[model samples]
Target chain A: MIKRKRRIETFSFFDHTGICKHLEKMAVKGWMIERLTNFGWIYRRIEPKNIKFEISYYPKASEFDPEPSDDQKTFHEFCAHTGWKLACTCAQLQIFYNELENPIPIETEPTLEVQTIHASAKKSFIPAYILLLILSVLQCFFLVSGLLGDPIDTLSNTAKLFSTVCFFILLIICTVELCCYFSWYGKAKRRQSKVSFINRQAHLFYRKLSLLL
Target chain B: MPRAKFQTLTEQMFYILLCLKDECYGLDILDKVPSMTAGRVNVGSGTLYNLLEQFLDAQIIRETKVEGRRRTYILTEKGKDMLKKEYERINAQVTDYKNIFEKEEIV
Candidate 1:
């Protein structure tokens, strides 16, 4: 009689795009996905390999937590109960695992360029807000100065004209700001969300690998 | 007057803390929880992010910006201590439940 053992395989990837692609590839290769952890930055893929089964766990350097603090310990305990592991660091591309521990070295490549992109994305909103504020103040000033016309008859008409122009300008600025804010916020948030999903997946895979080891 | 101690956290808070333990971001928590629980628990981005902000206020987790538009989370010492206590308490409960079942079987 032959004994068959259940094989649980887990793998992690730093590149979110790559992780997604790898999952697709695994699906084609007849690997059944058992679990996934989506951390928004990386993903952990747990699959059933051949009868022998293999668990592949990778970590991104960006999400690596070197020291577990009290809160982190609680978090880990929660995750452990749920059978999940911490995701990889963002700076890491590959992962090395051993019994009881997985160590990922920090990536040396400069990430300032990426940071600059995020910084600029946030800073861009300031100018838009400032422009709107200026327009609003100017409109208020024009109305208060009573420069549009005479006290009674012309004042109302002139004020109407000035107010109309101000209103239109304000409307345009507000519309643009609203649209830009949503677009910027959406794109930035979506990217962040995707990365986080991947990160959580990576963590899940790491935990599975730990069990296998 | 002394404040009353709560035995369990709100579901949102519990999930948020669970998300942060693994260095997750606000958005990541938003995406992960629903799928993790097989759609039984769905946490929207707004609610999850707010919960993370609260955790930050409570000093349970801290945020770190590592990549573009990515803010990662790490648990604080206080958070870990709380988590350890919670784990012990829960483990004790599970043990008690198991013992009860075992006693019934023996009887």
Candidate 2:
């Protein structure tokens, strides 16, 4: 029997570390992630064991591609050669898993890793925000014009009312998601600076400025 | 881009470029770096991959060969120069440390 569970996880966008850690804990308890989607993570029960999970951003990857591109395949092969097994992929975000006792985490250069994630987020998330902004502005324009032109028709239409509510809901979600992404990046950048492989001058500058203040 | 960032290499990058000095496969660097650093520095797969792309973009490294699912690369002239500069910078730091500590101990 293949037992499965769906966990609603919209907040994964807000918290990358939290989501990866949560998935690792789940894997520890014998539930392996069978499917990861915008809807939620679907897990299947397995023999109880520990597994290591790593999340990485591949700027070149795309969800619409019928197959993983040559570059993506080469990347996966290289990772497998180094012991990380590709667990799943959602758009630009790729997750790898290892059952080894102590596997090297795939992202060693902290500043580079943060920058990679930021670049990927900019490509995927920022566009959605722009689209949402345009749609909301258009919707509001239509709503206002409709009310001014004919109040009864605009208010009486149930479909438009429902869509307006949904548009607002989506707008709220877009705003929150964008905010969370930048906030998470802000914190992640600060954390990465500690273990950064480069950018010592920038770090020194920041320290000196903070001291001066 | 400033000239200084090009003048030095991070530990991860130094080892990476060092291993690629003789035209090595990408996977080989993962194993070679740990041994070279005596298990002190482990270049994670993602980091290595990204750095390779960045190096290629920056023309520090050039793809040399593609053999049966492996891609081999070697440091370019620019990469060699960067490595040499980084070596000198590290040596200078060590020299400065020895001078300061040894002189203080003598005093």
Best by TM-score: 2
- Enumerate the candidates' DockQ scores in order: 0.03, 0.50
- Highest DockQ: give the candidate number: 2
- Over A17-49, each residue of candidate 1 has an lDDT whose tens digit, in order, gives 435455445534544333333422232343433
Task: Estimate, for each residue in A124-203, the C-alpha lDDT of model 2 and write its tens digit.
Answer: 77787879967976786788899899999999998988788667666655665566566666766777542322233443
TM-score of chain B of each: 0.73, 0.91
Please identify model 1 stretches exceeding 4 Å from their true place: A1-213, B1-7, B66-70
